[model samples]
Target chain A: MNIVENFDLYAPRLINKKELLSAGHRACQGCGEVLAVRLMCKALGENTVIASATGCMEIISSMYPTTAWEVPWIHVAFENAAAVAAGVEAGLKGLRKKGKIDDRYIKVVGMAGDGGTMDIGLQALSGAMERGHDMLFVCFDNEAYMNTGIQRSSGTPMGASTTTAPAGKISSGQKTWKKNMAEIMVAHSVPYVATACPSYPLDFIRKVEKAKATKGPSYIHCFSVCPTGWRCGSHLAIAMGRLAVESGVFPLYEVENGKYKVSSEMPKKLKPVKDYFKGQGRFRHLGEAEIQVIQHKVESEYQKILDKVKYLKAWD
Target chain B: MAKRVGMEVAVAVAEAVGQCDIDMAAVYPITPQSHIAEHLSDLVADGKIDAEFVTVESEHSAMSAVIGASGTGARVYTATSSQGLMLMHELLPIASGMRLPIVMGIANRAVSGPLNILNDHSDIMPQRDSGWISLFVENGQEAIDLSIQAFKIAEHKDVLLPVCVNIDGFQLTHMVEPLEFPDQELVNKFLPPRVPYATLHPSKPVTMGAFAMSDYFTEMMKAKDEALKNSKKVIIDIWDEWARMFGRAYKPVETYKAEDAEILMLTMGSMGETAEVAIDALRAKGVSAGLIKLRLWRPFPFEEIRAAAKNAKKLIVTDRAVSFGGPGGPVFSEIKSALYHEAHRPAIYNYIIGLGGRDVTVKDFIGMVEKVIPYNAEKTVDTYEFWGVRE
Candidate 1:
């Protein structure tokens, strides 16, 4: 038997065995964030550095003197991941000019949860994007601030129950709709922006791969189903993310240089929004009226994406 | 070899920093600090410097972006004023704790309550414990000189802490003066390219700014403290080298005719020049008055302050920032705290003056000395007083 039977390494392997994100992370039983990050690492390979804002991922992966990251990572402040990524990009540029780094340039990735991206970190995200840092900002949206005990975030969906916005007497839980992070990134006019989910492993990897390939700033809004935060079964996290797309609640799409394309194949008629909402206890309090309202809202948002895609398709 | 050119202090600062050939400059505009950012932007756009100039949405983002850029092992610069500085307050400690050697310019302006935008030490005073080495300049030449030196001080391996060059708002930032712009080759030789301790590089991966539990937090804090406390040696070294290369000299505590004076007056920033005029006037009248300009605000010159105050029977500390409900002013409280344990301490008196762009003249300094004579620094109960407040 040959010691290295699989020595056809000349071909670009789609499934890299070298896990840069690595194991031994302190993530929960069925963490969608870790899975997505794992795939992201697998896509970028070893030539990458990550700037993570303070959140679940930061807390889980980095401990003093013992880090889960096999690659360079930094967690500076709560709201400045994108800003710090901007700095890293500039710093690398300077170092590269002086021939201080390897010729194959390290890819910079900024990671933050929904709260870090949609609320406190919004200004920094906008500024980094506007400045066009040659980096990628990947936002893991688990609906609420999961690291802070499931508090409502700007990305929390309307009718979803969180610790702060619980469904109690005379309360309909979160009154406002979830912030459209992918559309927001599109609005920033970044070179590449996309919606991704860990459930769709290939799609997630493909988008992340595209982000690394794009020259300027790129953003990926990955839907991570937090079982602990969403009051769902630990094993249902992956299925939940799939439902988020299959039911048209979180349609998988991409925007490239102002062109929108729905990457996930949708049926002529998507399954009822209730199929996406019913499994989670956070939305168990919803009545027929509330469910209908959510359904309508989801339909409207999904239609907007479809309209953009059809327009771009027609133009092309 | 150098040539003298007359320019605004802010523009001169831009010129000075430009000579450093920084990698990136993240800027946000606020009044009194606007000209510095505007000029730097122009320099970057016009290819005067091959650096990145990012006009961020806000000062908070400016600080954050610079932090990011600096983390990438890039030489970075930024500028801000009053409310802008206040907005950047949260991330200031993070930058220092991470040991990122980013240089920033503070056009020292008063903080707002009634929304006044003018010159004062109010803006920089509250940031004493933010883990940044602070320096103040007395004039346009000093402004230009120190802006360049700030980067050197900050980038020192022993003192890899961020440094702030606090230039008085419109008083110094707007005024024009002649300064000798040094040769770029000389600057390149003096300030070498940065050697980052650890950065975001995939070649050799390491984690930075990791969360510290109680077990490790104390040690981290102590390391930062020791790095700063020991930085005075580097600061003195940089100043000495600069003086040799150039003709101008600088010191932590610069004295003006204090060699044979009993009543020593202390001031910081541009007020030092005006206080020097008052000292000349006092000497002419034979009142035994002298002036001491405190150039370094952080790593507070405890020993120098004691030695200067040792010979004097009385010392008057003129401050520009109020501490509100506690001590009368920030500088006054700091000096008092420093002198509290001294064996032979002078009768110290503090007067809050020149706040919110209010000017203090030579006569006001002379008046301040007269006011300090009545109150004994050791024996008196009421040591704090405000000067030139309208009735």
Candidate 2:
């Protein structure tokens, strides 16, 4: 049976009563970034305003006169979305002081791609977190700068093929490992930090809701599989994302005020990282030796994360 | 009671910030502008000012923290110079676009390549188009006075925009001068409580700085432009009110010895005083040179400039900054544009001088006048030229 024919198997009912990200966006078909955004907006509802950085999501959603965003949305420059959101949040509070606005539960959220989050926007994000603004920051990690034609970004995984990090005679693609942004955010000692992937829609939605409920500086790092950059079949987007988590490549976890909790633990021996890498063309050039090295690294990192959670629990 | 005290312009600016009801100041010290932030930090630490003072890692972070603090409905301030100002260039536009009304002190310094950190207008000249109200203060008194006025003007409902109070690096920012410190109660009366039009509040939430689509993008820019243009009139009214209360007047262009004068010298910031000395010397020689100091840069005093230069036979425009391979300087081009369509316009000449604090002595000013007079006599003055360059 075709995938659409088996809709009951794959199609989850959208529970978000409010539609902040409207349908008919100009995002490319099967764009995982927009899917993540849709899920986040659904979780945030209409009471939130979003400040978006300049990227593929912003370009496609806001096309002059018409916008895919049902909520109040602003697209600032690539690196200053966090700062702009801070200003909006400040402006809101100032207005409230004068009793100009009626009291209502409202949230300010900032959304940006990996290029914006891990690189150019790092300082602004850190400053906002440090200031303890009542805000939520969401980073959609697509591994590469897919909007700018698949250039390499700090978030691009090691040995991954990108336009700038192409596999050739002198080098394996993307020599550097992906930046540990979740850990970096947790180090800021903010109230909350969590990692989620769109492959598990419910889990991603739950994290957004948790971030919204948090009082100050909640960060949600979302892993979004980019079919264009990953060189994977569009149909396998969700499957690849799922495999990444199941193989312990990208663990689902949350850190609350320096306390760690691993939400999904691998019970049996996790699947080899090779199983996850073999499907994507970005990792096609990896030999068996390199694959073994990647697997070892993934397993070791996963253990360290589990140990952190255990340590925090022991102290508590 | 108001009291006269001798203070550096940078110190005056710090004092102004200290006396204001500022809730927070996030700053990273940079050359020529460090004194302002340093003094403010000391004041905060000494309990002279009750404010959250953050010493940030970089200019970018300083601006970011200011944005964050300002979002919390706190009055915010910061300062930077030269390349530090360039690093904050991206944040400047964002601050204004979001209409946060952040009041900043910019010590006008030359931008870097060979890495010179002395005096010039290059640093702020590039930010002229960044949707900020630029106020050029001539001395310590104006620096103190304008810094206080900036907060009031920026936070006005119709003029909700960021303001940059520019003081010449090393010249005005460093030089000590006597200033009349306004009484605290009088200041409190003149500058009412800040009522932020927008802020982050749990109750009655409003969306600001929203993403604009192509459909609404033009309208958004138009709205900002309309606010800035409308602010010009508001600025005039506020300055008038300030004069009424303080007995000291301010205008977009302040004229001195211009009546019945045949030659006019147009300048900004500390160079205005230098030009005044040159004018006085020229007048002593019966040369009929007068001075017009530009107090406002953004919302470019076009009408005031036109009226100021209307009676002059020759207008010599001096800029401490250059516009690269384009015009002689950024201000010169704007002044020329403002006068292009006027009837019976004076012969205008552009000169780039005193870059990187290369001492713009009265002799240099007189030399500029000498070069302009011959060109005016022949009615064949070149539009622009570098004044003191080796070439």
Candidate 3:
């Protein structure tokens, strides 16, 4: 049995080099979401079926008569990727049990953007997880409805300017904090729940591989930097994702069976949230007062994870 | 061997569905629709059916899950009604456009305003343009028969469109009736295992439901429309084969005592039976009242509709759902549109009846026909009215 073993970040050669999401696609330059999708697909490989929600990845990867998907992929609609994946998993099981198909281990994957996951898609995702379907749901968190021209979504971070929630003299950007989707999946008591960033390529790949091996529902919330929507330099997309994790605004962590583990080693003193927001034009209007408020929230949330890690530590 | 058994219409419908050798079902429980889902769940639990029964959170997910399962080359099924159907409205087009052969049972109920959960066609009426093969069953026997045939019709290569077998909520679905269950071996022989045109498999990768811009959007819609239009022949073919194997026969626009009648009353769903009784009473009263039961709602059955109304001088179109501010009731408008170009067409009067499950007895049907009796081809009358509304 050729099973993907525990991955080592130091050994790049150990990773599967197959490009399941092929080239000739129309994603923007330095689009971190597409990069994350590409990396996750590499981890999933040929023995997988992806049920993608209608969002940026779906549009860019699949246009009629031409497709970047080298693997079997279905784009159903927004808000139902999890439900669809659950169905796919169940369908495969049914077919295999009926002896209509061989019992080869084909992973069922559901992929969606933040808006598709945290907001409109939440119920389906929750239902799928609760049902314990053998599938993996990945949320590419660009923090807004980027595919619909940077509209504010529940996933949009507080004070982040979007087309719908523009920062003005009379008003701040988005009024809500970024929804903790990975934590929400954990609440569903799924076997595996993780937060990853493609900038940490090894970590992202490893988590996906772990999800692939999982027998029940698994969810991964990926921090996908959007250069175009965020009004940041295209080149800073990867750096932006790394900054998101390092600044404690978005942490690299995993929860296994109700136990939490912070994947990345946090600095003794976390970088100020302003440092994470500095490069992006979306947060350019934020003054010290607003930044301080966001900074406080980030620190407290990050500390909550640390507290969970300290007390609930069970796995290595 | 087939034997008659007394069962609730909903339970029998689920049993009929189970016999289809379906691989998966994702259903949500809603009023008038809960029995189908519950019974199907029991069937799966009891090992009566080898299928995955996903009790979805909402009807939206139910439709989505079925679409996904069907895309994986599995014979999939689902059930919903009224508000549930309304909730599932968005994914309806997606399912048909993707051409997934999924069969669903809809215990028809009125869409809410005052939140009524009784029998009505308001639920399935608005889904007219969803590109699905829609069929209305008049009774328990038809519900069971049609539910089984749905899989065969939907999975047909020519018609890889989703099929919704609509049975009136409470009126038909909740009724206990003696219905014959076809032998499992015979059902398997009649409705062969689904042969999916394309599927999500590792060996053969395909991208379905791709983004289509203006350059290709119209063409994609045209293809879907053409596919639905072409599906009529396959539907008839399957029904014919079903009739040959079993003893029951069905038609898109079925008529009852309409021969040489001047006045024809049109009805859909379980109301057709009542309308028949009304026709008998009207004939006894020396009125030339007849009945036309529209069994197939989608792909509209235009030719059959026109042919059925040809000999009639006046057509009384009864609609259970209000089109609200539009041209009378939905079915009434459809009937008018279907007969618009014909040089010698009947004068059609639309009666919007049974909104939110108001009882439409035989007397009501007789009254509707009698009200339309005063009109003739030469003189114009009110095109439509809310039948039974207080003046």
Choose the strongest candidate by lDDT. Answer: 3
Q: DockQ values for all predictions?
A: 0.66, 0.27, 0.79
How high is the TM-score of chain A in each model?
0.94, 0.93, 0.95
Query: Comparing 2 and 3 by TM-score, which wins?
Result: 3
Candidate 2 chain B has its poorest 10 consecutive residues by lDDT at B200-209
Task: Give all TM-scores, in the order shown.
Answer: 0.96, 0.86, 0.97
Off by over 4 Å in 3: A1-12, A313-316
Leading candidate by DockQ: 3
The residue-by-residue lDDT of candidate 1 on B9-84, one tens digit each, is: 9999998999997988888999999999999989988988878777788888789878877877888999999999
- Please, what are the lDDT tens digits per residue for candidate 1 over residues A24-133? 98999988888998999898888888899999999888877678888888888889888878877777876687566666678889999999999999989988898788
Q: What is the interface RMSD of candidate 2, in Å?
A: 5.0
As for lDDT, the candidate ahead, 1 or 2, is 1
Chain A (candidate 1) TM-score to true chain A: 0.94
DockQ of structure 3: 0.79
**Error at A117, model 2, angstroms:** 1.6
In the range A179-297, model 2's lDDT, one tens digit per residue, is 99999998888888999988888888888999999998899999898888898888888888888888988889999878888875333567888889989999999888877878888
